[model samples]
Structure formats: structure tokens, C-alpha cells
Target: MSPFLTFKTFYTNPLNIEYFYIFLFTFLLALSLIAITYISGKIIKADKTHMAAMLLGCVFPNSGNYGAPVALFAFGAMAFDYAVIIMVIHAFLINSIGIFIASFGSEKSTTAREAMQRVIRMPVLYGALLGVLFQLLHFKLPPTIMEGISLVASATIPTVMLILGMQLAEIKPQLFALRYVNSVTVIRMVISPLLAALFVIFMPVSDTLKSVYILLAAMPVAANTTMLAIQFDVKPNLVSFTTFVTTLLSLLTIPLTIYILNMM
Candidate 1:
């Protein structure tokens, strides 16, 4: 079964409310990470454009495609539930908070009303809400419609990755020269997992949840951040380059992290 289906099925269980702490945990952790990255970027004297790019590339991860598989490989299929749950949270946060941050930090000055409007209009937020509602209400979609939706959902990650690769190809000659790209890469692929370890070490959740958080955090920058960048005109090339760099580096870093999580 798909990771998202696994996630939905788990939540739809009548007794699943007992595990709601995991959602709160992820929400707080995501906010903290975003805040820390935003402050750090400012402290480093990054310009608004770079700061926005840093927040976009560093705070989010490729939790669906890259993270879920890694969770399955490293911790077994049972643990995939946690990975998918975190992915859902990440998606919601990216569409709402991530978009707000990007808008606030955009090169063009934006008023509070405009930022709020952007977040409100993001379709991903609505989709996330509807997913939860459907699961909770036990609303069964028509078979053919569900199948088409599944097909489209399955295509999200690969499609974003392909777009990222193309954007990177265009920026190849100046990839390294792109301001804030390296710092964003390091923060996303390296510091994120480290912070996840620290976050989980003090939590009272089960080891399975801990493993999922670490693996999810260890994922590379979200490829869809490039799409957000392009959509918001928030330094698309720099964000895309950061996404490419971090994903390329995660091949080594993810395994290393899986080893660390295994030891814990």
C-alpha cells in the first residue's frame, strides 16, 4: 500500500486518537525548525531573498518519496506509518507556513493581508484538510476517482524532482556561486537530522516515532520548494539549486543517519 494510504488508514481507526500526540510533536518541531533557520539566516547577514530561500530549502524535507522509503528500508514497513504521518504534517506546514515565510521574505514588499491571502488560496492546504475530513468521516470516494487521485498523488514527488533537475541543469554553471545555496543544503540535509535527534531524545514517544522523526528530518530539501519559489518568485534558481545539492548529498547522509538511528 502507498505510504499515504497507510497513514490515512492508521488515523481512521476509531481508537487512533490516543496517538494524537505525534501530530502535536511534529507541529511544534516543524515550527521550531523554521524559526531557528529563519533566525540563523538573519544572524548570518543573509539578504531577504537568500533568507527566504534558506527558509524554504532548509526547513522542509522530501518526506514523501525519499523519507518514506528510507523509513521502510531502515525500520521496516511497520514504521512507514510514522513516516507517512510526518509527511502529511510536512505537506500541510509547507503549504501554509512555508508559503507565508516565502511571501514575507520575498524581494517585493508584501503586506500582511497579501501574505494571509496567499496562504488561504494555496490548494494544498485545502487538499490536506479534505484528506483529514474524508478519513475521519469515512467518506468513500468513487473507485475510479480514487484511482485517478492516487495516480496523481503518486506522481507528485517524481514530477517535482524532475522539475528540480531541469532547473538545476539551467543553473549548472553557477550552481555553487548561488548565494545561500550551500548553507541551505547543509542546514537541510545535515543539521536537520541532528536537531531531530535532539528533539526526540527528550520526548517520551515510542522508539518508532523517534526513528520516523529522525529519518524524516534527515531527508533532503523538498523538491516542491522549487515550485513554490517559482510560483512566488522567491529566488527560484537559488532554491532549486539548494534542493538539487541537498538531494544529491542525502545519498550518503541518509544512510549514515539510518545507521545512527539504528544504534539508538
Candidate 2:
């Protein structure tokens, strides 16, 4: 069978519904982490390092590179609209919440203007805008251009995953046990996604929207979080470790999430 057919069959299969429910459960777990972050911030008095790590963990996802392809593989063109919307939201959160957290307790803080500029300049933002514009205009890329984009974009996931693995190899296992690191992982990988899913479930969203929200929520922590941590002088190691932990954990969480959502 063709890949598209296989993708369709998988979604339609009775077993797949179980996967969907798992997605829902994981998303709820993620929301719980967000609450933890807020309460922790208040109780612990918002230490710069801890706050930054928590923020980095909570915001951003391996969406553009990892998510788009996975959506395409599992749901084909049917999933495109949902994927695009989630990507837009992801970009916004990274620029706003992610930036705020990274800047906390830092001497060289970014102003609103700087943050806006950074968001505007992000390639993901431009790519998503262009994708939506093209869809709205009903403009089609040349076969060659489409093929090229797909080929280049396809490399993004594996390249990112490999880099992430290498980075993870460098982490001292001890860091994983740190209070801040553990807190960030629980929030980023579990709480944030859950909140996003709950929003999707209650809102009058279409199935496409529901699927996209769940998929985006299930994504592991973005590698960019660590880069931002380094640039902003917010505990890069903590960010990296959180990324590693969440990404590794997502192997179980993501598949289960998809299963559960399918059932629901």
C-alpha cells in the first residue's frame, strides 16, 4: 500500500483510538506541570536559574522539524491545516513566554521591541506565514520547488534528533536529579501539552484542530530552548538536560498520547 493509504488506515483502525487517548492523558499531565511552575515560582521566590529552566522547558516544541513530518506521515494533507495553526502558536509562545523566562535574572535583558524583532526575524515564523499565505492564495509551488522544500525540510528532523542525542550524551547524569531540572521536565513535557489539549477539547474546534493541538503538545522540548538559554545566560546545562529528559521520555508519552486520543 502507498504511504498515504497506510496513514489513513492507521487512523481508521480501531487500535489507533487507544493511541489518541494516551495523547489526551499526556496533555493533561503537561498542564499539571504548568501549575507546578507557577506555584513553585511563587513559593521559591523565582530564582533566575530555576525560572529560566522552567520557562524553557514549558515553551517551544520540536514541531517544525519533528511535528510537520510526523503529521504528514500519519495524516497526510488532511493534517496540514492543524499543523500550521499549532506552529503559529508555538512560534508566538517561544518569542513571548520563552523569551521572558530566558531573560529573567539576567543583566542583559531584552526589551519588548527586541523581543518583537526577534520573533519577526525567526525563519519558522516566516515559513509558517508563507505557507499559510500560499494556502490562502491557492498558489502552487513549481514541482521542483516543492520537491526541494520537502527534501530540505525532511532533513530537519533527523539532523535535529542526532544533534540532540549528541548533546544528551554530554550531560552529567547528576544534573537530571537537580530540583530545577526535574521541575522543568514535568512542566514542559507534561503540563503545557495538557493545557493545550484541554483548550482544544472544550473549544468548538474541528478534528483537525484537535489532532494538531494534541500533536504539538506531545512534541519534545525544542533544541532552540538550549540555544536561547546559552545566549541569555540562563543555565544552558539545565535547559539542555531538560530537553534531553523530555525528548527521551516522549518516546513513551507521544505514542501513548496518540493511542489515547484515537480512542477518544
Candidate 3:
């Protein structure tokens, strides 16, 4: 419940210093996956929309609803703080870098100014910054206010899942037959996690934090990819398909990954 305690330990304790590296690793791993997928799509002579779809799918993971709960279950509530940090990094990256890539890769020509505007318009980064500021400053709110915040936060996951379902309903039937679908799936559900595992091995964090990282790595494509794709007109159907497929695939992969990590 006291994430500030974990954040404090992260800075003051030598053994926990790797917590800073976790943010770097998560951001770099995501960028690396996006780069790999984008290049692979180019090498394969994929179309603009398909390549954009690859960016959307491979660059982001469902770190919130899917990753948080899995971390809570596998590593308990303490690890949930690590998951929150990962998700915060994930959100910032998705809002800025993710949007830029999706916009640039799309069929339309996006200027740097436009991209900058899109990134600035996103509130996640500001929210994350304010949250950390409050934690660092030991700012306390009333219990009644905290309770209301908790109540609203509890609805986030289900609301995201509902949005995903609605996005699926918007997918055209023809996109299902696209040949690039398998490639997107492979990049998202397979290669991304493998890259994350390498980071996990090298990270100096505790075993529980390592487990949280790996589990978050194995999560499905971000459900928000669909919304971003739709917003940027960046091959929404393919993005939605990859989101749906990767999420369905994770039902098997995530649990199996948890068991494997335990055995390791």
C-alpha cells in the first residue's frame, strides 16, 4: 500500500539501486522491439499500413490490466509497486514515443510539430510526474478523498477491457485475412518477452522484481494500441487484430510464464 516506502528504498539502498535501471530497461526494451519489428516489416516489403500496425502492436504491452494483476498474483502486493512503476514508464513511452511512431508510420505525413503537440496533449505523463512529486514530497490527502480515488481506479481495468471489446467490434472482417497478422503476433507475444528476459537477467533487482519484469514482458499488446491506431488512422484493423490475438494468446502464455519463472 505504501509505494513511497518502496520508492524511498529504491534510492537509498545499494541493493535496490537497480530500480532506477528498471525504468531505463523497460523504455529501451520497448524501443528496441519497435525498431526490430519496423525493420523486419520493411525487409519483408510490407505496406505502409502493415508496417504501422507492427509499430503499434510491438511497441506497447497491456501492462495495466493484464500485467498488474498477474504481478499481484505471482509476486504479491509488494511487487505490485514494481508493476506500477513499469506501467508508468510504459504509459509515458506510449503517450510520447508510441504516438510519434504510429503517426509517422501512418499513411499521412505527420510533421514534427504535430507529433510534439500530440505528445504534449497526452495527460499520462503529467499525471505520472505529479504522482511522483507528491510521493517524494510526502504530500498527504484526506482519507475520504483517497477512498474516492481508489473507487475510480478500481474501474480502470474493466473499462479498458470494455474499450478493447468495442474496438474489436469496429474491426472490418477483411482485415482478418491479412498475411501480416502472424508476423505481428510473433513480434508482440514472442520476441518482445524474449528481449525483456534478457533485460531481466542483467538487471540487479531482487528476484521478485525480476519476476515482475518478466511477467510484464510476457503480457499482450497494449489495449490502448487500438485506440491510438484508430486515432492516427494507422491501420486500426491490423492493430486491433494484433491486440486481440496477443491478448488471447497471453491467457496461455502468461500463466505458463509464471510457472516457468517459479521453477527457475
lDDT on C-alpha atoms for all candidate structures: 0.72, 0.63, 0.73
Q: What is the TM-score of each candidate against the true structure?
A: 0.77, 0.73, 0.83
Residues 150-244, candidate 2, lDDT per residue (tens digit)? 66655554665476667667765444446676666666667766776766766554576577677777787787777788888887777777777
lDDT per residue (tens digit) for residues 74-114 in model 3:
88867776876788678778877877777776766667787
Off-target runs (Cα >4 Å) in candidate 2 are: 1-36, 44-46, 134-147, 150-159, 166-172
**Ten-residue segment with the worst summed lDDT in candidate 3?**
1-10
Query: Which 10 successive residues of model 1 have the least lDDT summed?
Result: 6-15
CA displacement after TM-score superposition, residue 212 of candidate 3 (Å):
1.6
Residue 18 lDDT (model 2): 32
Model 2, residue 93: C-alpha shift (Å):
2.4
Using alpha carbons, what is the TM-score of model 3? Answer: 0.83
Tens digits of lDDT, candidate 1, 1-264: 243453343434333542576677677767777787877787778878778878888888988667876777789766766676677678767877777777777765556686577667755555656666777788877888777666765555565446545655664434445347767877777778888888777778778878888889888888778778887788888787777678778888888888887886
Q: Which of candidates 2 and 3 is the stronger one according to TM-score?
A: 3
How many steric clashes between backbone atoms does each model show? 0, 25, 0
Candidate 1, clashing residue pairs? none
Name the regions of candidate 1 deviating beyond 4 angstroms.
1-7, 10-19, 107-173, 176-179
Q: Which should have the higher lDDT, number 1 or number 3?
A: 3
Model 3 has an lDDT value of 0.73
